[model samples]
Target: MESRFAEPSVLILVSLASGPKHGYALIKDIEEVAGATLGPGTLYGALSRLEQRGLIEALPAEERRRPYRITAAGAEAVQAYLEHVRQVAAVGLRRLGAAHA
Candidate 1:
């Protein structure tokens, strides 16, 4: 199946791939990587969707913070999305020339 990757989903998947993390940590990581803060409602909404899709699963809780890990399917989806983005960037870069001069 084609990846259901949107901006938030892709970002969340990438964040989880590094290792399992709690919701707050994931939000911080994504914001740090993106150099901007993502809204709490938007982040939790995407997390719910990702969990519902079976791309991520909740880990045993510690101190009321629920951690999550990327499922195998999530890895595949994120990889495919990244590859597609790379290809698009490559095409755009290749088209850059002295046209602005």
Candidate 2:
């Protein structure tokens, strides 16, 4: 199945791939990798959708903020999505090579 991960959701998932993280940390990491900033509401909204889709789970509150971890199914979905991207990239590069030649 196509993951259809939106930009924010994909960034969140890629951030969570390393480990569980609270909202603030996710924002920082996503900025570092994605070069885009996510406001609190946007981040939490994506988090909620990921949770609802069973791709992620909110951990019990450590204090006021809750952390989140990726589910196994989520991991699989990310992998599949990445593989599809890789294939697309390879094809595009092949075309680029031909154009360059």
Candidate 3:
């Protein structure tokens, strides 16, 4: 199978790039940053995959919550992914602008 990060996984990494966060915190951050609300199952599922891929790491539990931080590889991944997104958006915007002109 092709090993590609899903949109939710990308968003999770994006959120963690700023700092570490627990499950609920990650969910809220994703909603705030991406404007998409992930259910508990979806959010935790992405977190699990991200951890398995070494994109993020879980810190020791603080109280009842365990937070995960992005690894260096995760930051690189985010940078590359955003660049791709930027290129696509720029081209699409240019096309739309010309169409309206």
Candidate 2 Cα outliers beyond 4 Å, as residue runs: 1-6
Residue 71 Cα positional deviation in candidate 1, in Å, after optimal superposition: 0.4
CA RMSD (A), model 2: 4.7
The full ranking of all candidates by lDDT, starting with the best, is 2, 3, 1
Candidates in order, TM-scores: namely 0.87, 0.87, 0.90
Off by over 4 Å in 1: 1-6
RMSD of each: 5.4, 4.7, 5.2
Least accurate stretch of 10 residues (summed lDDT) in model 1? 92-101
Model 1, 1-101: lDDT tens digits are 54433588888999999999998898899878765456889888988999999999989999999999999999998999899999997887777744544
Best by TM-score: 3
lDDT of 3 at 72: 95
lDDT tens digits, residue span 1-101, model 3: 54233489888988998899998998898878777788889888988998898889999999999999999998998899999988998999999999999
lDDT of 2 by residue, 10-83 (tens): 78888999999999999999888777789999999999999999999999998898999999988888889889
